[model samples]
Target: MDHKAKHILIVGGGYVGLYTGLRLQRALRRELKSGSVRITVIDPQSYMTYQPFLPEAAAGNLSPRHVVTPLRRVLSKVRIRNGKVTKVHHANRSVTFEPNAGPSEEIEYDVIVMAAGSISRTLPIPGLADAAIGFKSVGEAIALRNRVLALLDRADSTDDEEVRRRALTFVVVGAGFAGVEALAELEDMARDAVKYYDRLSEKDLRWVLVEASDRILPEVGPEMGRWTLEELRERGIEVKMKTLLKSCEGGHVVLSDGDAFESATIVWTAGVKPSPVVNAGDLPLDERGRIMTTTKLTVSGTNGAFAAGDVAGVPDVTNPGQYCAPNAQHAVRQAKVLADNIVRHLQDRPLREYRHKYAGSVAGLGLHKGVANVYGVKLHGLPAWFMHRTYHLSRVPTVNRKVRVVADWTLALFFKRETVSLGEIESPRDDFRAAAATG
Candidate 1:
């Protein structure tokens, strides 16, 4: 690390932190003098995942690598550390990091930006934390893809009808964008994969979407949500609205509404809560557990301490009734302001508040179909779907990732999306062991 320069330590290399550091590098370079600054970004993963493309990655429409922006590559001027941040010392302006191998380290900073983002919000449902998978990062997306394809292989190879049926039955526990699109994309992929399996047919598989709400995609209004329900059901996906998964025991799911089913895939995208880091040191947080912040984006009761993204409950100015919902668009913009504020603070300048309106929600519903609500216009089916992909591909972090993503889509236009499940990627040596043992 460059000890001679002033350091701006940023926590969480997710949407906000990554983008904040990216802007800080450029802003600080133009905004600061030589030996004036060094921005250090610390997070467990070294890449920022473009979450919107995860459904496509799960469906094999975009290559997994194309959706991720490597922090080191993108933020060359910033020091990148791959580790978990344990504590923030506001008084001393230092942060404690627990590296994978080295003794716990502490780095003093002139300013700190809290952009740790959020984690998968899980309920206390039995067997969920252990058995259910999360839909937050690249690993889970890749894992879900692998599992979907593996289910087909397992169905094809198995002689037991019960086992095959269970293998083909997929349960996604949230009807939000992540849950809906993941289930939709994978279901489309799995259904196509049936052609390669002798025993497996589209009829043999089941995709169940369980939501506790009265309707799905609240951002898109009830009508569109109902239309989505019809569209999914028409495609053979069981949209179980007004219900939820009560438990997951021995790969069997118990729904809250007195129903049960056996399935190999259980994905939890119910929503997200603030990272415990926001309140880990007993920081001031709103009742909902998010760090309280002003529209200008500073922690409500603290000076020199800033929080944004999934953690900061910045009041939504446009909608008087609520706080800004934690989404990628807000996170990306807030990071820019947060970085600017930090730069101004360093120069003893005035800080600016954050303000933005909801641009509405966009969702990919597998293949050429999608759903979106921008400004008051609600859309469903193919047109919405095209807009969904177009919008996300445009904002996916970097030109490198953007080009690769566009190429992936362009190539996919000519080729049918790869429905072939590489589930064996989860356990690569399974095939070799069976043949060698039998031989």
Candidate 2:
């Protein structure tokens, strides 16, 4: 391979792709300036979302725009392409991407970094595709917030008992961090929003949390998880354990535990699987369809091809016989190691193994309420809530975004959360198109 000018193609622009490109832009600064190497990042979106803040965004505590970082602005030296890689011909050292407004194009590279991340893991539940919404992106978070507030408006304006009950009941499936936090935050928001309605009381709103697993928040340990369940139940939120969402047709939800309910909002946060990019080419994938990578973050038995983050099944060096769990904490740290290893590989230097200990987790139940188990220390209530804010604020990516998020929080201290829902934003051209057709 010629060492004159190398092209490093980074696929996906989420946690792994964006962070890896940022680190590479700095580590290869001299090489980039001297025209010895060039980096290109490709993704469908122009920005990388900080997913940890999705729940707060949904609950109206944070602005939706502030939780995401623009990639082109963050990595100025690295070329940015807003498109989707439809195919990867690794052996030919080339990839095909379909641009947003142009025909599909192909580009060849000297090195490839596959960090396409994951998508919402869905099931074949009846009416799921049409009735349920997945909680993954900032758009979904904002849409959910709007939907929740819109439901409140619907309930307050309605006179029929059935219509009001259906509009006020909210259902959330899954018991992981995403589902738990989303449910807790929205429940708190709804309870607060009710205070402004003369006809609606807290009892008028029904919140249901259905989990297929035996317990919720498995990441925070059994003790904390149990306590969280009790707390939510104390707030009148139904905690249905060992239950499954059998069907949700026309806003009628049927659960496995012989319970039936009507709800206008259903949020699905079951889990995530590797992105479709995992099968973009003939890459070796594990049972879960993740690209198989060695502990060094290199594709097994392949040269000049590497992968990390949720899309790659990277063996955990800290754990004897397990692969790293797909999470932001792992993805952020893995990118640094992955970028360093890629640079070492280019420079013909010995690569170092990636390893890190689990640092534990923190979760916010609602405003000024949380639970955290960090490094064997467990905390709850106000202290845990403050820690959750502090930790994520520090890791929100880019100084500007961090500042904006803090400003939002600081402003929240003096003001109330905005409860107005602009559902028309989703269909801005509806009235215009209707009038034009009638004319």
Candidate 3:
């Protein structure tokens, strides 16, 4: 193989893209030194968010910026492109992309890595696209923290009882990890925030969690899942099982079980589908629109093309006849092996297959409350909450972020979590625009 310059293009800047680029940067030392290899990372966002910390961040337990790692700062050697890949032609090793603010252009590469992550899989319920908020991004988490506190303020100031009731009632759909943790954290924050308002007592506020499945946290096993359900119910959270959100038109929430109520806030955390990137490319995709890959992490039946993480349906060696589950743990581990395989391919060496045994799951249910099932050992309450924090603390991207997260927790030990909501952050320029128009 000629040692001429070889360009490798990575699509998406999420967990898989970021980790794979970083690994390549480390592994291709000689190639990089000789200027024989060039790596470019493309994504809509310039930063990678640590998704597990989003719940804590939403609860004001951590700063929003601390949860995101800037791609340029971390991937120094790799070129960072802030854009979306509009189309991929793997047969020709070329991609057409549109930058954040520019015309679409095409680029050819020697190798292509598809790391486009998933997005919220939503139903076409009435008023959902306009009213309900998703719990996936940093913006959503920060907005939620502000919105939750603002709801309390609205309830306390309203004279109409119906208005107060609507403002105080919060509905969360989906009971998976994202849904459960988000509901728990916000519930905890609201419980703590209400104490300051004399007009808003604990009884005045209502929290509802709706799950389509028979139970929540299926990864934690039925025993722990039931325990979590009971624990959530014991905290006065209305856990509606085997129910679906019919609609949230104008904050009037309707459920599948013939229940209807008025809620000012409805958080959607149900599930995610493969990002549209899979559809943008010509690669072979599963019925669900996920790129199909072999156990070795290469795009099925294609050379010089690879994929991993939420967007790729990589055959699961441990489970057999099934693909790997989409989660941070799997994405991270798969990225390491994917990076190694890419380097091996370039070096004309054999690639290693990727396999991982399930390590169990952990979840935080409000302060000092959680559930975990590690290696078949089920734990509940404070111990599980501690494990939830400890495990994620270790996995969070950089050391700087880890320290900031720990500091947030340490300060919480002494000082209270800041409940003040500058909801104006959402529309900081609104006042200025109004003033300018009046002037």
Candidate 4:
């Protein structure tokens, strides 16, 4: 057996990348220690965010720091590079890496794992890039939390009715898990926060959810989706289904239904497409720009190349003629198979195919409110909400993060939700710059 050293390069540090690296480091511990196997993970961010908790973090139900795990700490045995893969030249077994600073360089590898995940799929709507925010990253979540609270403060301090009204209206686009949960959780937080304000009440706040599709939470089936819609509407949230956001020019929302309103906050969570980095490679891609992979998680017609998670179109053998849904459930499970296969490939052993049954879906609407359909059993309201938190808590990666998140929730039971906005953190240098100028 040739024990020559081999370098494996993972393209993204998201769910798939982090988990695969973790598994490989542990499984190939001897090889890694002996310098026979080298693994390098390249990502723009140093931490992998538990995206399921982004809504809770934004709602002040959980701390933003607790929702992310540092890649260095978790993948201690693997080399971590804080950079983005600008291009993947799989034909040459190298990729172009662009660091946070300086020039781009090419990184060669023996095995390349295209775990680069998806990004928010947005339209070219007018003023969208400037007026709207995405709910993808931890930074975006924290910024949004501050933005919502700061808007509340602005509305309270303003004398003009128009300004107050605009500041009070919040619009969330999309009705999927991200959009719905963010809207519900933030609305709950704002409703609770209004009690502390002298002039503001829950009645003054307008929460609108715009969905181009007729149904929301379609993953949970139509019955549960309809139930969620009713529950949100019962809470005074206007659910505009089958309606499109025509434009949000200058914070003024123009809907396809001919309704117009002013909202200071517009959240976009409609959909996500494969990362553009995939296209820069010579690998074969599907029509949707996702890397085409077999049931075994290996890149189609390519050796020493694998892909999983949102970036890969992995065939679901369990559900014939369909690809696995790009979700955390599939990503986490696929990582285990991918890591094992990499080891198997290295050892000249047969690789195992990746297959898993769909475990339904659970979504938290707000505190004590949720909907779930697990293995044909349906649950709603408090039970579903509890399941939502419990499931995500169990899946949040490290024990440290799980413990911290639990502590936050435990404290929330005794204390009121934090409503203070730390918008200044976004630009910490602003105050110092002003003071220096005066001096």
Q: Which is superior by lDDT, 2 or 4? A: 4
- Model 1: lDDT equals 0.84
**What is the TM-score of each predicted model, taking all chains together?**
0.95, 0.98, 0.98, 0.98
Give the per-residue lDDT of model 3 (tens digit) for 24-66. Answer: 9999978877889999999999999999999999998888988
lDDT per residue (tens digit) for residues 389-430 in model 1? 888877888888888988998998898777666666778899
lDDT of 2 by residue, 106-171 (tens): 999999999998899989888788899989999999999999999899999989999999999999
Scored by lDDT, model 2 comes in at 0.91
Clash totals in order = 3, 0, 0, 0
lDDT of 4 by residue, 1-439 (tens): 2356799999999999999999999999998988988999999999999999999999999988999999999999999999899888888989999998889998889999999899999999998999999999999999999999999999999899999999999999999989999999999999988898999998999999999998999999999999999999999999999999999999999999999999999999999999999888799999888999989999999999999999999999999989999999999999999999999999989999998999999998889999999999999999999999999999999899999999999999999888999999999999999999999
In candidate 1, where is summed lDDT lowest over 10 consecutive residues? Answer: 30-39
Using lDDT, give the best candidate's number: 4
Candidate 3 global lDDT: 0.92
User: Which 10 consecutive residues of model 2 have the lowest summed lDDT?
Assistant: 1-10
Off by over 4 Å in 1: 1-4, 30-33, 427-439
